[model samples]
Target: MADFDYDLFVIGGGSGGVRAARTAAATGARVALAEESRMGGTCVIRGCVPKKLMVFASDYADLAEDAKAYGWDAEIGTFDWPRFRGKLHAELDRLEKVYRSMLEKSDVEVFDSRARLADAHSVELADGVRKTAKHILIATGGHPFRPDMPCADLGLVSNDLFLMEELPKNVLIIGGGYIACEFACILNGLGVDVTLYHRGGQILRGFDEEARGLVAEMIADSGVSIHTGTNIVEMKLADEVDVETGTISNSDAALGAPAKNDSTSLGENPKSETRQKAGKRIWVKSTTGREGTFDHVIFATGRRPSTADMGLEDVGVELGRSGEIVVDEYSQSTVPSIYAIGDVTSRLELTPVAIREGMAFVETVFKGNRTPVDHELVPSAVFTRPELGTIGLTEEEASERGEIEVYCTSFRPMRQAFIDKPARTLLKLIVDRETRVILGCHIVADEAGEMIQLVGIAVKAGMTKEQFDRTCAVHPTISEEIVTMREPVRAG
Candidate 1:
C-alpha cells in the first residue's frame, strides 16, 4: 500500500467514478479520482440535472393553463432565462461542492484535471504528474456527437445549449432522439418557434410504439413543428444585405448555394460577434428539399463515449467499435488491473445504472466480494413535454419473445378533462402469457417518470399480471389506470 500512491485510481469525476472512489475509500482503500471538468460529470453538469431543471421551467406554461382550468385565474408571463439560468448554475455549483465534500470526508484524493492511462496500473494527469495505483477505474462518461456534414460546425450540440446567453427567437432541432424532442418541447414551451427534423418516421425509436406515439402527438400538439423523414442537407450563414440596417440578403440564395467554409463559422469562435450573427439566421436546406432560415440549428443526433486520446489503446485496453471500453459483467476490462463503468462502457447510459456499476466495482475490488452489475429491467424516463417512463420490454420486444398480452389506456386525464385540454395520458402493461408475469410497464403522461419507478419495483420483483390485478386501485388519479385495467386490450 505504501509503494503505490493509491489503492484505486478512478478517472472521470462522473457518477460512476465518484461512487467508486467514495465507496472504495470507505473500505480503507487509498482512492484517488481525477476529473477534467466538473465533479458531477454529465448528469450533474450538462446532461440530466440541468436538463430536468429546464424541463420544469418549460412546463410552467402548461401548468398556468391547468391552473386557469381549475378556476384559479392564472396566466403565464415570459420565461426569464437569465434569472433561471443563474439559479440553475448556483444549484449545480452547490451540488458539485457536495460531491467534493463527500469525497473529502471519505478521504478520497481528487485531481481537477484530465487523466489518462500511463499503463495498466498507472494514471497520468494533465499536469505532467503520473501516479501509480494497484487498480485503475475509468468512468469518463460521454459527449454529444454531431454528424459530419457540410457546414455542420454551424449547428450546436447539447452541451452548447446550457451556455447560451439567451434562447433564440426560432430554432431548428435536428434528430428524433429524446434529447431533440425534449429540447423542442422546452423551447416551444418557453415561447420559441421550434421545428424538429428527423430522418425517421417517428420520434423515440426504441421505446414502446404506443407510448412513443402518444408522446409524439403530445409534443406536436404543444406547438413544435415536427418534420419526419427529413434531414439537413446543407447549412450556411445568411448573407448580409446591409450591415448598418442588420438586414439579411437573398436568404433563398444562401440556402440554395453549397455551404462555403468561411471565417464566420463556429469553428473560428462561436462567441464572436460574427459567429453570433451567423447563428441568428442560418440558411438551411433539408433532404426533403425545403429551404428556410432559423435563428439557431441544434443537433441532438447522438453522443459518443469520452474515451478518445485517453491512452487506453496505447495501454492495450480493448475498446469496442464505438470506442466504448468493453467490460465483463463484473466491470473488469481485458486488462485485469483496469476496469470501467458508466456511459464510457455504454452498458446503460442512466446515472443510476452508472452508480450501481460503481458500487459493484468497489465491492468486487475493495471488499473481496464478487459483485456483477445487473443491466436488466431498469426503469428510465424521458423528460419530454409529457414524459415517457418505461421499464422492461417494449410491446414489440415482448411479443417476439413469447405469447403476450398488452393492456393500455389513453385518454384525457381528469385535470385536462376539466379544462377540455387536448392533453392525454397513457398507462400500459405488457404481460407474458406463459408465466403470467408483467413483462413491461410503460407510462406516457405528466410525472410518468415517477410512476414508472414504482412500477419498475413490481416488474423487478417478478410480479405477475394477476398480482397487479389484485392490488387496489387509487381512484381519481392517472396511475389508478395502471391497476384498474381488467381486460387485455390486445392478446396474441
Candidate 2:
C-alpha cells in the first residue's frame, strides 16, 4: 500500500468543501482542505448572506411608508449607505471566523492558499508546497460574468457591487436573471434610479410565466425601470478630449471605437461613430439602435464555474460542455478515486443539494453505506421585490410529460389592498391528473421564500391534491391560498 498524507484533500473551503471535510473527518478519516479566499466562500461572503442583508435594508423604505398605518407619526426618513456597508462587512467577517472555528473543531486542517492539481492524488499550494492524498474533491463554485461591451472595463460585476463606497444616483443594470432583478429591487427601493436591461422577452425565464409576470410587476412597482429583449451593443464612456483647437471638453465620441481587427463589428456604425457625441452620460446603442446611459452600470448577467486556475486539466478530470465537472448520482467524478459536488458539478446550484451530495459521498466512500441524492423535489427561491419560491415542475412541464391539473390563485394581499400598492401575489399548485399527486408549488409574494418551504416538504412527501384540500386554511393568511384555491382557471 502507498503512503498517503491524508485520507481526503479538498480544494475550496466553500459549503460543499467544508461539509464534506467535516463529515469525512467525523467518520475518523484524516482530511485537509485549502481555500484561496475567506472560509465561508460565496454564500457566506458575497452571494446569500450579504444579498439577504441588502434585501432587508431595502425593505425599510416600504416599511417606513407603512409606519403611519401602525399609528406612528410620519417623520423624516433617511438612509446611510456607508453605515450599512460597514455593518454588513463586520457581520460577514464574524461569520468567516465562525466557519473557520467550526472546521478546526472537526479536526480538518485548513490551508489558506490556492490548491492546484499537481497530479491525480497530489495537490500543490500557491507557494509551490505539495501534498499527497488518497482522494481529492473540488467544490470551487462559480463567479459572476459580465457582457463583453466596448467599455466593459468600466462596468461592475455582482461581486464588486457589494464593495461600492457610494451608491449611484442613477444606475443601469444589465441582465434579466435573478441577480439583476434582485439588485434592481434593492437599489430602486433604496431610492436609486434603476434601469434593468435584458435580452429576453421576459424576466426570470425558467420560472412559471404567471409567477414571472407577477415578479416583474412587483419589481416595476418598486421603482425600477425595466427593459426586456435588449442588450448593450456599445458603451460610450464620458471622458475629456482635447479638440484640434486645443480646447478640452467632455466628449463621448473621443474614446476610440472597439477594435475591429478581430472581425467583430462590435455593433457600431463606422460612419456615425464620432458624429453622435452626447452629454455627461455616454449613449449606448442597442442591437435595435436604442441609446441611453446612466451614472453606473452593473452586469448581473450570469455566473460561470470558477475552475479556471485550479488546474483541472493537469489531473485529467473531465468537465461537462458547460465547463462544470462531470459527476454521477453518487458525486463520483469520471476519475473513480476523486469526487465532486455543488455548483462546480451543476447538478443543482442550491446549498441544500450540495450538502446532501457531500453527506451521500462520505457515506458510500467512508462509512460503508451507499446513498444517492434525489434531485426531483429540490426547492429554490428568488429574492426579488416580491420574492419568488418554487419546487418541482412547472405546469407546462408537468402537462407535457403527462396529464396534470393546475390550481392557481391571484389576488392583492390585505396589506396591499389597504395601501393601494399597485401589486399582487400569485400562488400555484400543479398535480398529476391521474395519480392526483402534488407535482409543484410556486409562490410569489412578500414572504414567499419562507412560505414555500413547507409546501416543498408536502410535495416531497408525495402529498396529493385531495390531501392539500383536506387541510384547514389559516384564515387571513396569504399562504392559505395554497390549500383554499379549489378551482383553477382552465387553460386550453
Candidate 3:
C-alpha cells in the first residue's frame, strides 16, 4: 500500500484522531486515519464509557438498600456479573460500529493497522505498508502501568481488568488515583470483597481537600476498607507450597516491615516468594509492614502517553521533558506541518477536551480560522461512592492570590438523613472580595459531577457571586445552595 496522497494523516483513531480527521476531511482536505485496535479508544472501549456504566450500576446497590426506607420492600439483592458484563460488551460493540460508520461516511481513509512514523510526512503501517500526508497527527492515548513486584505479573492492568473472563471473588486494588477509586466502587457494588490500598493520606489527591475528605468518609461507610498512606512493597501469588506464605497476605497488617519477619518459623527457606501461576492469591508487603492476600489484584496506578513503538523521534516531532509531544496553541507540533492533540500532547486528558482540541486544530489549519484551545476552566468528575466534581480554583488557591471571601456549607443530604446513612454533602464557593466574582466553585456530594457541569458554564463565563445570588433559587434542590448562600463562612 504505497498510497502517499493525503493532506492530513491522523494516527490512532481514538476520540481526538477521529474528530480531527473528520473535521479536516469535511473542509476539503484529504485525510487518512489509522487505528490498530477498536475505534473510540479508551473512553468508549474501556475507560470512561464502561467505567461510568459500572458507576451507575454500583450506585444501584446502595439505592436498592435505600429503597426499603422509601416504603418499597426491596429484597436483599445479588448482582449478576455475567449479565452485567454482557450488557457492557454489547453497548461497546455498538459504539465501535457507530464510530467506524461515522469515519467511513465522512470519506476519511481509514486504516485498520497501527501507524508509525516512516518520516516527517509519511507513516508506515504495521504490515510495512506506507502512506504520506502533508501533516501527521499523533493521538495515541495511554495505558495503565503495574510496577515490578514479585507477583506483579499475576495481576491485571486497566485494559485487562475490563476483559476479565469472570468477575473476581475478592479483589485487592493497588492505587490511590481516581482510577483506583472508581474500580473499588465497581467491585464492591458487584459483591466482590474489595480492599483498596493507596500510598497517600487521601485518594484523588489533586482535587479540592474537602472533596477528598467527603469521599473518604462515604466510601468507608459503604463497606470499602480504604487503606491510605500504605504501599504494596511485594506481591506473591497464592497457593504456594510454603505454609507461612498465606499469613503474609493479610490486609490489616503490613507485609514488608522488618519487625514482622518471623525468623524462627521460616528456618531460612529462601524467604518464600513462590506464587501459583493460575490462581488468584497475592501476598503483598506494604511500607507499613502490611501483608494481604486477595482473590484478584487490580493495578489502577496511572497512565503515560502511548507514543512508544510509533517512532515519534524518527519523525523529528518534539516531545516535552515528560515525553509528550510539544504542540502550540493551535495544537501544531514543532514540525510545522505536523500536529498532535489529546493525551499524547499532555494538555488535557479528558475525552471532551481531546475532542475540542481536535476540532480547534482542524478549525485553525483547515477551516482557515485562527482558533486556540483554552484549557483554563474545564470541569471534571470522579465516580467514587460519593462522587466528586469541581471547576475553577480552590478556596485556598483563590485566597493565596488576594483577599477572598469563602462560603462553605456542610449538611446531611435529606435523603441520607432519613435512611440513617451518615453521609454529608459539601459545597464551597471562593468569591473575590473586591470584585464579588465567584473565583471558584467546588462540590463533593452525590451527583457532584452532574452538578458541576452547570457550575462550569458559569465559571467559564466569569459569573460573579452577585450574579449567582441574583439568580432565583430552585427550591428543594441541593444545587440551589450556590445561589442561596447568604454570608461568607470565612473572610480573609
Candidate 4:
C-alpha cells in the first residue's frame, strides 16, 4: 500500500473546511489543513459576521426616534465609525483565534499557507511545499466581483466595505441582490445617503416575488433610492468628469437639460485632500444617460468561486462556467480522491449549508458511510432593515409543480403600529391543493430570520396546511399571523 502523510488534507479554513478537518481528526484519522488568510474565512472574517454587526449598529439608528414615541427622552449621538471599526476588528481577531483553537484541539495539523492540488492525492502550498493525503477536500469559498468596465476600479465590492477607514457620506450601490440591498439599508441607517441601481426588473430575483418585493419596499422606505432596470455605463474620477464632461444629458429631460457645474457636482466642500484619501469622487452615467456624482460606488454585482490559479483542471476536476468546482451528490469531484464543498462548489452559498456539505463529505469518504448531500428545503435569511426569511418552493415554483394556494398577510405589527412607523410585517405560505402540504413559507419583518428557523423545521417536515392551522397562535406577536393565516389570498 502506498503511504500518505495524512489521511485527509482539507483546503480552506472557512467554516466548511474547519468542520471537516476537526471531524475527520476526531475519527482518529491524520488530518492537515491550510489557510492563506484569516482562519474564519468569509463568514467570520468579512461576509456574515461583520456584516451582521453593521446590521445591529444600523438598527439602532431609528431607536432614538422610536424612543421619543415610547415616552423616553432620547436622541442618538453621532456614530463613531472608527471606534466601531476598531471593536469589529478586535472581535474578528478573537473569532479567528477561536477557529484556530478548534483545529488544534481536534489534533488537526494546520499550515498558514494557500493550498492547491499537486495531483489526485498530493496538495501543494504557495511556498511549493507538497503534502500527500489519502483524500483532499477543497472549500476555499468565494469572493465578491467587480464589473469589467473602464474606471471600474473606482467602484468597491462588498468585501471592501468592511475595510473602509471611514464610511462615505453617500454611496451609490449597484446590483439588486441581497448584498446590495443589505448595504443600502446599512448605509442609510448609518446616516449615509444611498442610491441603488440594478439592471434587473426587480431585486432578489430567485426569491418569492411578493416577499422580495416587500423587502425592497421596506428598504426603499428607509430612504434607499432604488432604480431598477438601471446600470452604470460610464464611471470617471470627479477631476476627469469636471474637465471632460462637456455635454451632460438629463435623459429624463427632452430639451434644455442643465449641464453640471463644479459647485453642484458632488459635495459642497469637495476637499481635494479628503477626496484623495477617501479614494476619489466618482461620476457615474447610468445606462439611461442620466449622470450623478457620489462619494462612493459599490458593486455588489456577483461572486465567483475561488477556483482560479488552482491546478484542478490538470488533475481532471470538472468546474462549472462560474469557476465553481463541479461535484456530485457525495461531494466528489471527477477526480475521485479530490472532493469539494461550500461556496467553492456553488451548490448553496450560505455558511450553514457549507458546513453541512462538509459533514456529508466526511460521512461519505471517511466513515464508510456514503451520504449524498441533500440540497432541498434549506431556509435562507437576508438581514436587511427588516429581515427576509424564506424556505421551500416559492408560490411561482409550487404553482409550476402543481396547483398552489398562497395564503399571505401584510400588516403593520403591533410594535410598529404603536410607534406609528410605516414598517409592515409579511407572512406567506404556499400550499399544494391536493396534497394539502405547505410547500413554502416566507416572512418579512424584524426577527424574521429567527422566526424562519422553526418555520423551516415544519416546512422541511412536509407539514400540511391543516397541520399549521392545528397549531396554537402566540398572540400579541408578529409571528402569530403565520399560524393564523387561514384563507388563501390567491390560488391557481
Candidate 5:
C-alpha cells in the first residue's frame, strides 16, 4: 500500500468515476481521478442535460400553437439556434466547474488528461506520467457508433448536434432508437423538414409497443416524415449528384447493388471548405427507392463502449463483443485490482445507474461492505415529442413471464380537447394476474418523464394494484389517471 501513489486511482471522471472518487476520498483515502475531457462527462456535457434543454426548446413551438387556440395572442417565431447554443454551452461550463469544485472540496486529486491502464494496479497518463494505485476503476463511458458503410463518415452523430452553427433546413435521421426519434422531433419543432428512416416496422423498438406506437403517431402528426422499413443505400454530396433526365433507380431494390462512388468522397478532409460545405447538403438514395437532397444526414444508429487502446485487454481484463468491460455485480473486472462501471460496462447506460453503481463500488471496496448494485426496476424516459416514461417490464415482457392484466387507455386530454387539438395522451398499467401487483407502468403524454419517476417508487416498493386504487387521485391532473384506472382492458 505504501508503494502505491494512491489508495484508489479512478479513470474517466464521468458520473460513476467522479462519484466513486469523491466518496472514497471522503473516507480519507488518497484518491485520484483522471479525465481526458470535460469534468462532467457525457451527461452534463453532451448527452442528457443538453438534449433535455433542446427538448424544452422544441416544446415551445407546440405551446405557442396551444396558446393561440386558448384565445391568447401568442406569436411564435423562428428558433434562435446561435443564442440557445451559447447559453447551453455556458450552462455546461458552469456545471463542469461545479463538478471540479466538488472534487476539490473532497480533497481528491484530479488529472485533466487521458489515462490508460499500465498494469493491474497502475495507470499511465498521455504525457508518460505513471502512477500506481492499490486499486483502479474504469468509467470511461461510451461514444456513438457509425456503421461500416460507404459515405458513413459524411453523416453526423449525436455528439455533433451540440456544436452545429445552425440547424439544417431539411434533415434525414437514420435509426429507430430513442436518440434518433428524439432528435427528429426536436428538429421538426425547430421548423426543420425532418425525415426519419428506420429499417424496421416501427420506431423505439424495445419500448412498450403500445406506448411507442402512440409516440410514432404523434411524431408523424407533428410534421415529421417517418419511413419505416427504410434505410440509406447510397449517398453523395448535393453538388456531386448527376441531374440526369432518366428514371430514378428503385432505392429499395438497389440495396444489394454495388454503390456508385459519388463525387464527394467520404475520405475528403473534413477541415477543407468543400467537405464543410458538403455537410450542409447531402443527396441520399434510400432503400425505399426515394432519392432526395437533405441539408444534413444524422446517424443515431447506436453506441459502443469507449474501451479501445486503454490496455485493459493487455492486462487480462475481459471485454465483451462490443468492447464493453466485463464486470461482475460488484463491478470488479477479471483482474482483482481492476473495476469498471457505467456505460463502459454496458449495464443500464443511465447516469443515475452509474452514480448508484459508483456508490456501491465505494461500499464494497472502501467501506468493507460487499453490496451488489441492483439493476432492476429502473425507470427511464424517451424524450420524444410527447415523451414516453416507463418502468419495470414492458407489457410484451410481462405477458411472456405469466398471466397479466393490462389496463390501457388513450384519449384526447382536456387541454387538447378544448382547443380541438388532435393530440392524445396514453396511460397504461400492467399488473400480474396472480399477485395483483403492478408489474409495469407506461405513460405517453406531456411530462410523462416526471410521472414515471413517482411510478418507479411504487413499482419498486412492490405496491399492489389495490394500493394504487386506494390512493386518492389529484383532481385535474394527467397523472391522476394512473391511480384512477379501473378494469383491465385485456387479461391473459
Candidate 6:
C-alpha cells in the first residue's frame, strides 16, 4: 500500500462529508476533512437547521388566532425581528460548535480551507497545501443558482435568507420551487407583504399537480400574492430606473444594499455593490409586463452542484452538464480513488439522502463491503403551510407506466373545520391495479411531512391496497383517511 497522509480526505464539511469523516474515523481510518467556511456546512449553517427554525418562528403567527378560535383570549403583538434574529444566530453558532466538537471526538484531522483535487490521490487546499490520501470524498453540496441578467445580482439566493439583519417588509420571491414557496409562507407569516412570481404555470413543479395546486390556494389564503408564469426580466436600483417616478424613498436611496453573493463587475456598474444589497428596495419589471418595487427580490430558481473550479475535470473525473460529479451506485467517481456524495453528486439533494450516501461510501471503501446508496422510494416534504409530503411516484408518473388506481380525498380537517379555517387536507394513494401493490402515498395537510415518513415505510415494503385497508384507522386523525378510503376514486 502506498503511504498517504489520510486514509480518506473529505472535501466539504456538509452533512454527508461530516458524517462520512466521523464514521470513517470511528473505524480507525486516518480521515481528514476540509471546510472552506463554517464547520456545519449548508444544512447546519444555512439550509435545513436555520430554515426549519424560521419555519417554527413563522408558525407562531397563527398561534394567537388559533387560540382565540378555541376560545382562549389572546392577541399577537408585533414581532421583534432583531431579538429573534440575534437568538437565531446564537443557536446556529451553537450547532456549528456541536458539529466541530463531534468531528474532534472522532479523531479526524480538520482543515479550515477549501480543498480540491490536485490529482486522483492528492488534494489541494486553498493555501496551496497539498495532502495525499488513499481515497478522496467530495461532499461540497449544491448552491442556489440565479438567472443570468444584468442586475440578477440584486436577488437573494436561499443561503442569504439566513444571514439577513432584518426581514423585508415587502419582498418579491422569484421561482416556483419549494425554497420560494416556503419563504413566501415564512415571510407572509412574519407579517411581510409577500409577492411570489414563477415562470412556470404552477408552484412546486415535479410534485403531484393536485396537491401543489391546493398548496398554492392555501399559500394565497395566507396573504401571499402568487403569480404563476411570471419572471423578473428587468431590475435595477430605484435611482437608476427613475428616482422621481420610482418608489425609492430619499432615506431608502441613501441606504445601500448589503454586499452578498459573488462580486460582480463593479467597473461595469459603479453602484452595483450598493445596488444589490439585501436591504435596498428594487424596481423590477416582470415578464408579464407588470412593474413593481419591493424591499427584496429572491431567486429560488434552482440549485446546481457546487463543483465549480474544483479541478474534478482536470484530474479526469467526469462531471455532468450541471457540474454534478457523475458517481456510480457506490458513489465512486471516474477516478477510482475519488468518490462523491450529497448535492455535489446531484443524485438526491435531501440532507438525509446525503447522509445515507456517506454511510454507503464508508461501507464500500473502508469496511470492504461494497454498498450502493439506495435512491428509490424516498420520502420528501415541502414545509409550506399545509405541508406536502410524498413518497414514490406521482399520480402522473405511475399511470403512464402501467394500470393504476388513484384514491384521493380532500377535506377540511376537524380542527380546522371547527375553527372555521378554510385550510384543507389531501391524502392520496396510487396503487398498481395488477397486483394491488401501493405504488405511492401523498399527503397534503398539517404535519403532512410527518405523515409521509411512516407511509414511506409501507410503500417501500410494497404493501398492497388490501393491506392498507386491513390496517385499523387511527381515530379522529386526518391520516386515518388514507386507510379508510376503500374504493379507488378513479382508475385507468
Instruction: Give the C-alpha lDDT of model 1.
Output: 0.86
Tell me which residue pairs clash in candidate 4.
none
As a TM-score, model 1 comes out at 0.93
- Which 10 successive residues of model 4 have the least lDDT summed? 259-268
RMSD in angstroms between candidate 2 and the native structure over all alpha carbons: 5.8
Q: What are the clash counts of all predictions, listed in order? A: 0, 0, 13, 0, 3, 2
For model 1, the superposed segments whose C-alpha errors exceed 4 Å read 239-274, 277-279
- lDDT per residue for candidate 3 within 189-301, as digits (tens), equals 87788888898888877777876888888888778888999878777544444425434444332232232111011012122222222444665667889776676777777
lDDT values, one for every candidate: 0.86, 0.80, 0.79, 0.86, 0.87, 0.86
Query: Any runs in candidate 2 off by more than 4 Å, and if so which?
Result: 240-283
State each model's C-alpha RMSD to the native: 3.7, 5.8, 6.8, 6.4, 4.4, 3.7
lDDT of 5 at 191: 85
- Model 4, CA-based lDDT: 0.86
How does each model score on TM-score? Answer: 0.93, 0.91, 0.91, 0.93, 0.93, 0.94
Candidate 4, after superposition: displacement of residue 385 in Å?
1.5
Q: What is candidate 6's lDDT per residue for 334-434, written digit by digit as tens?
A: 99999999998889899999999999999999999999999999999999997999999989999999999999999999998999999899999999999
Q: Per-residue lDDT for 1-492 in model 5, tens only? A: 258999999998788899999999998899999998888888888899999999889888877778888988998888899999999999988999999999999999999988999899889999999999999999999887666776666677787788777777888999999999999988998889999999999999989999999999999999999999999987755443333433333344222223222212112224223445554356788998998877778889988888888999999999999889999999999999999989999999999999999999999999999999999999999999798999988999999999999998899989889999898999999999989999999999988999999999999999999999999999998888898889999986
Q: Write the per-residue lDDT of candidate 1 for residues 254-334, one digit (tens) a residue.
A: 434322222121122353234565544677889989887777788888878888889999998999998999999999999
In model 3, state the lDDT of residue 328.
Answer: 87
Q: What lDDT, from 0 to 1, does candidate 3 have? A: 0.79
lDDT of 5 at 116: 96
* lDDT per residue (tens digit) for residues 163-244 in model 2: 7667767888889988899999988878899988899999998888888988998788777888888888876555323222
